[model samples]
Target: MAAKLEGGAYLSSFVDAVLEKLSPILEDDDFVLEENDSALELLGRLERSLYDVGSVLDDAELKQFSDKKVKKWLVDLQDALYKADDLLDELSTKAATATQRDPDQLQHKSLRELYVEACDSLKLLPLGDFPNLKKLMISKCQSMECVVVPQALPSLQYLSISECPSLVSLPALTLTVPQLEELHICDCPEINCFAEEFLPPSLKTLEVTKCQKLASWITSKGLQSEGLTHLWLGPCFDVKSFPREGCLPASLQALKLSNFPNLETLDCKGLHHLTSLKSLAITDCEKLENITEEHLLPSIEHIYIGEDCPLRWKLARRDGRPMV
Candidate 1:
C-alpha cells in the first residue's frame, strides 16, 4: 500500500512536468510548422489532453490507494503520456532539421571568404558556385579528404590548404579558377600530385612545404605554370635535387628552396633557361654539395645561402659570383 502511494505521487509529479514542458512549445510563435499542419494540430490536441489528464492527476493519486483498478488506470495513463512526449520531441527535432537544411538560412551566395578549421568529422566539401568568392582557406581538418569543385569560381584569387593529413589530391583547378593568382599548400602528407595537368596560367605565386610525395612529383614532373613568378619549395626531405631539365618556366623570377635535408645536386641545365630568374635562396640544405655549373646563375643578382650548407663554403670561395 505504501509503494502504491509512492508510485501515485511520482506519476502526479511527472504529469505536471510534462504539462509544463508542453505549455511553452504550444505557445511559442517562432516555432515553425510550415508544412506540418497536421503535426501542429496533433500537438494542440496532445496539449489539451495533457491538461485534462493533469486536472485528474491529484484525484487519481488519492483514489489509487483505495482502488487497485484506479492504480492500473494511472499507470496506463503514464505510459500513454510517455508516448505523447516522444512524439512531441520527434516533431520538434524534424522542424529544427528542416529549418537548418533551408538554403536561405545560410545565405552562402553572398559569402566572400570562407575559412574552415579543426572540424574533425568533416570528410568532404561539395562546394557550389560562389560567383563573388575571392579567397578560400582550409586548415587543421583531420578527416577532410576531398573538396568537390563542380564548376568555375570566376573571381577567386587566392587559395590555401594546410595540415589536412587525409587529403589525397586537389580538384582539377587548371581551368576552374582562371583569375587565381596565389596558391599555398603545406603539411598535407597524403597529397601526391595536382589533379590537373597544369596549374592555372594566371598563377603568379606558389608555395609548397613539408609535403614529401607532392615534392617528389613536382621534382619529377616539373612545376608547369607559364606566368608563375615567385616559387618556394621546402623542408620536403625527399627531394634530392632541384629542378629537372625544363622543369621551371622561363617566366620565373624568384625562387627559394630550404630545409631539404637530402638535396645533393643543383642541375645547371635546369637553371640555364630561367633567363628572368633574379633572386635565389637556398637554406638549411645539409647534404647539398654540387652545383653542376656556376656560370648558369648569370641573371641572378641576389643569392642567399644558409650557414649549415656545404654549398655556402663553396659559394664563399668562388670569385665573381653574386652572393648576398
Candidate 2:
C-alpha cells in the first residue's frame, strides 16, 4: 500500500503494493523465523515497517495507513500483532550482539515454542502446558501410551481418543475444569483406566464405547462426578455389571446400555437415587437375564428396548397398577 501513498492510487490497488512489500519480506535472507513462528514474526516485521515509515511519514499518514489496513483476523493477523511486538523488543537489544543466526535473515527457524510436535510413532501423550488448544483428537494415534494434562488448557473443551488400540493409561487428572465437558474414550482397547481422582466433576456427557477395561471407570472410587446427563456405553463387551447404585451421584436423565456380552443383569440397587430418570434404553445385551421391577425407576417416563432380545418382564406392583 506504500506505493499509493501519493493519493493517486485507488484503494482497489492496495493488493499490489501489499504483495510487493510482503514478497520481499518473505524472501529476505536474514528473516529467520520458523514456519510456525513466521505468522508472529511477520506481524513483528509489519510493526517494524510501520515504525520505520514513521521516520519520514507524518503521524497523520501513519494513522491513515493503520486505519485503512484490512485484516482477516486469523492466524496471520494474530501472529503479526502479538508476536511482532514481542519480537521488536527482543531484537532491539539482541541485534548488535546476537550471535545465533538471526531468524530475521532466514525464511524459517526451529521452534520449541509451546507444545511438542506430534510424532509419527509416539502414542501416549502428556499435554500439561499446551498452548491455546480447543480440541485434542488422538483417535488415529494408535501407538499412544499415556497423556499428561497441561496446567493452563483454558480453551480446551473437547477431547477424543477413539480407536487407539495400544493406549494403556492417561495422566491422572489434576485439572478439574468444568469447561471440558465432553470426553470421548471409545474403541481404545488398551486404555484400562483414567485419572479417577481428578476426573472432571462437571462433565455432562461421556462416550466410552468398545473399551472393555474402561468399565473400571464406573466403579472407581475416585470418580465423584454428579453432573452427567447423557451416557453412551456401547460395545463394552467386557463390562459384566453396571457400577452398583449410589456410585453414580447424578440422577441420570438418559441412560443407554448396549452390547455388553458378559453382562448378566443390570442391578440398579443404587439407581434409586437417580430420581430424574427420564429415558432408559437397553439394546443388544444378549446376556441380560432380568431387570427387577422392585427398584424400577419411579420418574422414568420413556423406554426403548433393543432388538434381538426376549424379555419376560414381571410387574410386581402391589397396587396392581397397569404395567408400563
Candidate 3:
C-alpha cells in the first residue's frame, strides 16, 4: 500500500524519559550537545524510524536489525544514563499526566516502565496496577535495596528490574500479579531465581544478568517445555552444574549463558527425551571443564560459548553415539 509519513510516531513515557536523560548528557558533552541539542530532534528521528519500521514490521530485517537494536538501545541507554534524576522526574511527570489525561490515546501505551538515575529506594505501587502494562522497568536505583511489585498487575507482558544492588529476590509467582511473556532481570546482586516458587508458563523470553545467587527453581529434574523461546542466564554468580535432569523441554529455541564463573559441566542427563532444542550458548564459564554430550538434544542448530571454557562440546545422537 501507500508508505506513510513519519508524523505518527508516539513516543512513550519511557522513550521521553530516555530522551530527557540523554538531553543533559548530550549537553555535558559539548560536541554531542552541539550536534544534538534538542531531545525533540532525537524523538523526531526515532519517530521517523518507527514509521519506516511500521511498514516492514513483518520482515526479519526490521525485527532483527531495526527493532532489536533500536528498542534495545533505548533500554540500555535508559539503564546507563546515571545522575539524571531531575530529568527523569520531569519525564515521569509527563508520563503521569499522559496516564491521567487520555485513556483512549494510543500514541504510545506501555504498562509499567520506570527510569531512576541513582535511587536509594523505590516506591512503584503509586504507579498503580494497570492491566495493560506490558513492561515494568526500574534502573539505576543505586542505593535501592528492596522492591515489592504490586500484585494487582497480572497482564504484565514484560518486566525489567535492573542495576538495583540491594534486590535479593522477587517474592513468589503465586503472589505476583500474573504471568508474563518476557522478563529481563539484570545487575541485581541480591536477587536470585526467576521466581521463588514456580516458572510461569506464560514466560517465553528472559534475559538475566549479574545476579549472584540464581538457583531457586528446582521444582523438578524435568524443567522442560515447548513454551520457552529465549533463555538467558548470564553475568550471574554461583551457577554450576546443569539441572540434574537438565531442561528436557522439547520447545526450546535459543539459549545464552556467559560470565558464569562457577559452571563446571553441562550434562543434560534429564533432557534425553528432548528433540527440539536449537541454539545453545555458554560463555565465560571459567570453571567449566567438560561437556558430556552423550545424550544432548538432536535439534541443535546454533551453539555459542566462551573461549575460557575448556569443555569439548558435542551432540549425542540417538542410540548414544558422539557426533564429534
Best by TM-score: 1
> Could you give candidate 1's per-residue lDDT for residues 90-196 as a string of tens digits?
44433332323344543445558877666566677556657678899989878889877778888889999999999897888886788999999999999999987
Q: Candidate 3 at 93: error in angstroms?
A: 7.6
Counting only residues 3 or more apart in sequence or on different chains, how many pairs clash (N, Cα, C under 3 Å) in candidate 2? Answer: 31
Structural similarity to truth (TM-score) of each candidate = 0.68, 0.57, 0.56
What tens-digit string does per-residue lDDT give for candidate 3 at 6-70? Answer: 11232234345555554544343322123344864664565454445445433432343445665
Q: Provide the RMSD of all predictions against the true structure, rounded to 1 decimal.
A: 11.7, 14.5, 15.7
Q: Whose lDDT is greatest here?
A: 1
User: What TM-score does model 3 achieve against the real structure?
Assistant: 0.56
What C-alpha root-mean-square deviation, in Å, does candidate 1 show against the real structure? Answer: 11.7
| Candidate 3: segments with Cα more than 4 A from true spot | 1-117, 121-126, 171-179, 194-196, 215-226, 236-240, 246-250, 293-295, 313-324
